[model samples]
Target chain A: MNRIRKNPIFIIVSFFLLINVFFIITAGDSFFQLDNYFYVLKQTAMIIIVASAARFL
Target chain B: MTGNYDLSTGSVVSFAGCVYALMIKSGMALLPAGIVAVVVGILIGVINGTMVAKFNFPPFIATLCMMYISRGVALILANGATIRDNMPPEIGNLASRDFLGLPIFVVFIIIALLIFVFIEKKTLLGKYALAIGGNKNAAFFSGINTAAIIFAIYVIIGGLAGFAGVMSASRLSAGDPRGMVGFEFDVILAIILGGTSLSGGKGSVIGTFFGALVVACLGNGLDMLNILTFWQSILKGIIFVLAIVLNEKVMKNISKKTVAAARA
Candidate 1:
């Protein structure tokens, strides 16, 4: 069970790194911009609030 | 049987909610309007069940067809315009009303969870849904009413979807045909996170609640960490595959232990 869980976590981290690398290599300056970071967070806020409300559900 | 049930929900929400808004728009009373929308949802489910159970169409195809049909009907019913006017305030109140400082919709979900938990644990309907899902052919041989059970399952799911539709429309104060485009995926992810097997036959209502939390957290975390939506989808798929693998292994171990204990 631990191995099964671990393998996926590793894959997720690796995928995350791979995407970040790709974006940096292609658009280095824009990829690391603070505004972009905030923009993504802004879009994710609603999903978070709606999804987290399931705890109450 | 339920592996594709999510497909029906996507359109059912849109379709039923559309009917609800339209009914009120046409000057129908709140009670009757809500009833009409719910009936439409159940009828769609019955049609889906008939297609899969009696006519021998594959569940995926039949429900996929229903999804498109229902969505089309919704879009047409509103004449491609969003319905925001002429709705009775009482109808909207069902979704937005507060109970003890909590949103009514959240309360509804809790109640739904409680009722589902009871049905899953204490009712024959729950047992049969599992039995049929586990093995339809064997369930048939054992004298179970597989067809009827399957029909009931779809109809129940449809009714729930209808309720969701109405709540959504009420909250927004209008029904938009284009709403909830990919919500089915989020719901499926929640169910799977809840430890329900994608292959069917095993599920826990409580687990689903937790699974929903997990998805929400992951989505939130990803966004906070600056991950792109494109990458988020891929990562989500990976997590689902990994979770299923983990769940299968755990189930196998538990079953093996039970078998050994029986022999002892």
Candidate 2:
């Protein structure tokens, strides 16, 4: 488990999973909708992609 | 990532929302809607990056100038109208249309994401951009043409802003001189929220993705909860501040941990 935690892939995945759990718990019922999931994914995708471009520096 | 959504959602919202609001006000068409939004976004990005990296102008000052420039241009085009009717039909379709069970804006966001990721991962330019951010002096010393990299960054930003502008025009179906007021505010907020330091260097595309998501969720939640407009603004402001602080702390911790591990 510690070895997996050391991997960037695992770290990133775990971070995202924890974030999802937070949303599920705090966003009430809105977090459960299919549309909401898609919306969040789209939003997440945009920031990561764009910010990554800047990150190349 | 719902509860702890990326702050970039703020930018996406402002970009899309401004267009939608303006389109409803004037009735712009669809193609123009997408085009304008993209153009405007790229333009601002370019101007901000260029002035700071090349002229040594501070990012805050450079962007502050652009904020006014964008708004001023919009106001000039609109002839002083804030809201009006007779927007183009092409832009109107943007608000009304969806593709494959999703909003058109959603698709645009996806395309924007993929293109940027490709730029970051698959190009020499990408490495240069990161190099500049990570250590400008070192990059210059190592034979990287710092000015060129900055120029390319600005050009990309300008093109994106121009595209955003077209979208804005279409979304409103009319071009108002006053369109996209305080848009840079949202973009900055989103970028900051995604862990992009204002001081330059040390930011993550992945973090930014979450940042934008967080902003969008906040707005969506507020609207759903029927929160007042004023309260919404206040809430967003608070979130932006908190996100910046938290991002910095998290980055610090990550670095500290990495160092400790290395020593051990």
Candidate 3:
């Protein structure tokens, strides 16, 4: 609980990120499927690159 | 279902074309339609900037109002239709043809992006924009025309929104005011996800582009995964909240480290 308070934001972001990843990974064909591979990559790349670059701005 | 994303083969043109398909199916023109969309978007952006900076209206309120105005105008122009019928011949060609394996729509986006980058990086107005965002009081004290700058920014914002509207019309082959309802939220969400601060001191065009991409990607992923439409909204909202919360934490951490270093 104290740990959560020390870095609530971090925990929150990490939580969502983990959820996203879990859903992406565990859903398999029923969940992930193979048809939209490029779509997923394009999106993940865009988010990571854009979100990380806020440091420069 | 897991770990199946392919990075080597993504095409912006194809993406644009796919969107175009939806518009065309609804009976809208394609070329002039797209051009008009871009112009309107820029107008909306400009209006947003002007209202906030010049009139001294709250930025959030001003933008929110403008969003409704823009959409309402589109709906009125389209006469309550989601797509236009019997568009010009040029419109169909632009939507259908590919240049060197790329859709014309993709080229259009690239050009728009290039112009945006040039304006943001290589111009004095850009410098002033950043300065004002960083410290309005300091910028005004340093002889910058903060009011004029803000007005200009709002116009640009309004204009961009208009452009999006036009694009929506073109893709749908008809001017549908209701096309992509709640899209403003998506735009803001992308911006925040890209790391722009709501407090108005930090933002990046590059970040925005990436943020937009992220949103586009997420939507695509959901579709591929067969996620329900209602769940998409929920997911996006969750992301928005998480981004702000994360940003606050990151800022706090940085400040703490700075203070510790000063003490040392």
DockQ of each: 0.06, 0.26, 0.11
List model 2 lDDT by residue over A1-57, tens digit each: 764544333443455566566666766788768888676554334333344344332
* Model 2, span B48-152: residue lDDT tens: 666766787755566557665655555554456643465435444554468998876677777776776676668877677667666678988999988777766
List, in order, the clash count of every candidate structure: 1, 80, 48
Question: lDDT (0-100) at residue B237 of candidate 2?
Answer: 85
Give the winner by lDDT: 1
How do all the candidates rank in terms of TM-score, highest first?
1, 2, 3
- For residue B40, give model 2's deviation from the true position in Å: 6.6
Q: Candidate 1 regions off by >4 Å?
A: A1-57, B1-6, B85-91, B220-232, B259-264
RMSDs, each prediction?
Answer: 7.6, 5.9, 9.1
- TM-score (0 to 1) for chain B of model 3: 0.75
Top-TM-score candidate index: 1
Compared with the true structure, model 2 gives a TM-score of 0.72
Error of 3 at B40 (Å): 4.7
Distance from true location, Cα of B178 in model 3, Å: 1.1
Where is model 2 chain A poorest over a 10-residue stretch in terms of lDDT? A48-57
Candidate 1 per-residue C-alpha lDDT over B10-88 given as tens digits, one digit per residue, 9 for 90 to 100? 7788888899898887888877888888888789878988887788787778888988998899989888878876666
Winner on lDDT (1 vs 3): 1
